[model samples]
Target chain A: EPEVTQTPSHQVTQMGQEVILRCVPISNHLYFYWYRQILGQKVEFLVSFYNNEISEKSEIFDDQFSVERPDGSNFTLKIRSTKLEDSAMYFCASRGPTEIHYEQYFGPGTRLTVT
Target chain B: SQQGEEDPQALSIQEGENATMNCSYKTSINNLQWYRQNSGRGLVHLILIRSNEREKHSGRLRVTLDTSKKSSSLLITASRAADTASYFCATYVMGFQKLVFGTGTRLLVSP
Candidate 1:
């Protein structure tokens, strides 16, 4: 089955450096999302992208965070200045055209470590 | 906060036994979904029960949703050692377009 894939399975960055997490959602998917899991905690939604614009975002997704679909298959999340709290597993997910059922496919996730 | 809570922070069962996890949500939702995550890995979609539907089954997995009570349960029967993982319930809201995940139930099926 086709699945969402993310690049840089693991990353280590300085506290004030920039990091870009990349994902390639399923080719036909229209809705894309970014979420983070802090260590063993529950997953938290960051932002959702559809129709080339942000549909919704959480308070956790502040000015430091931005998402871009620079190409047809590539969706990227960039953090301007990483904080210690930014060390977490960042996941990328995608869903098909239907909006009601809301079934999503998640990628393996990129583990971001800020020091 | 994405509105769902799960209990039994951890559970242990032997292979061939059954495992059940429960989830409770605070508000109305379009559907409730169950997902599994291995240690330090991404999530895998398991099952979805719509607010209008009462129960659903896939393989040895069964899910029931009680919209009126705002709770749901997932049962895994005749489980295997490989079933050891953290199970999460996510609540889906309409126009907000988000899936808020619960704390999750960690199941350890020993061989």
Candidate 2:
């Protein structure tokens, strides 16, 4: 079965540096999303994208965060500046074209560690 | 006590036993989904139950949704040690495009 795949399984960066987490969602899926989970915390939604634009975002997805579909298959999340609290497992997910009652397939996730 | 919360945060059982996890949500949802995550790894989709449906089953996994009560349960029967993982319930709320995830239940199935 086709699955969502992410690059740089583990990333380490300085507190003030920028980092880009990349994902290649299933080729035919229509909706893409980004979520994060702090160690021992529930998965939190960051942003959702569709039709080449952001559909919705959470408070945590402030100015520092941006997502883009730079290419047909690549969906990336860029953090302008990383904070210690930003360290977490970032996951990318994609859902099929069906309008409703579809499950989102998740990638293995990129573990971001900011020091 | 957030949008989605799972009860009995941790559960332990032996192989061949059954495991049940429950989830409660605060708002009206379009659908409820169950996912599993191994230690420090990615999440794997398990099953999905729509708000309009009362129950769904896939393999040995069974899920039931009670829209009126805003609750859902996931049951894994005749489980194996490989079933040991953290299980989470995610809700796609009405009018929202994002999925809200629960705190998750860590299941440890010993051999």
Candidate 3:
């Protein structure tokens, strides 16, 4: 089974620095999403993308956050200026056509630690 | 602030025992999904139940959705140590493209 892949499984950056989390969704999947989970908290949706554009976003996805499909295979989430609260497990997910119904496959996730 | 909330934040059971977790949501939804996450690992999709569906099953896992009450439950039968993980219930609210996940239930299946 093809899985979503993310780079830099663990990232450590200084506060106020810019960081981009990269993901390579399944080749054929059309819908891509980014979600984050604070330690011991529920996973929160950040943004959803389709056709290389944002379909929807949450309040957490403020001006500091941006997503890009720079290439056919790469979907990235960029934080213009990091904060301590930005430290969390960021996950990338993709969905493709399925016979039963649609389902999003999640990647292993990138643990972002901002200090 | 709109999100699903799971009950019994944590559970512990022995191998071969059955584990049950419950979830409740505040809004109408198109579908409900369950996911599992191991410690320090990413989430794994377990199952999804549409709003119109009452129940669904996969392997040892069973999920039931009651739209009237806006609640769902996940049951894991004949559990094993490997089944120990954090289980989350996510709801896809109507007219939205993103999912809102609950706080999750951490289960520890002891060998």
- Which candidate's TM-score is highest? 2
Please give the interface root mean square deviation for model 3, in Å: 0.6
Model 1 clash tally?
A: 0
Error of 2 at B79 (Å): 1.0
| Candidate 3 residue lDDT tens string, A37-89 | 99988899999998879999999999999999999999999999999999999
DockQ (C-alpha based) per candidate is 0.94, 0.93, 0.91
Q: Over 4 Å off in model 2, which ranges?
A: none
Scoring only chain A, what TM-score does candidate 3 earn?
A: 0.96
Worst 10 residues of 3 chain A by lDDT: A95-104
Better of 1 and 2 by lDDT: 2
> What is the DockQ ranking, best to worst?
1, 2, 3
RMSD of each: 1.1, 0.8, 1.5
Q: Predictions ranked by lDDT, top down?
A: 2, 1, 3
Error of 1 at A16 (Å): 0.7
- lDDT for A31 (candidate 2): 95
Candidate 1 accuracy as lDDT: 0.94
Q: Candidate 2 — which pairs collide?
A: none
Candidate 3 TM-score versus the reference:
0.97
* Candidate 1 structure quality by residue, lDDT tens digits, B19-52: 9998999888888999999998999999998889
| Best DockQ among the predictions, by candidate number | 1
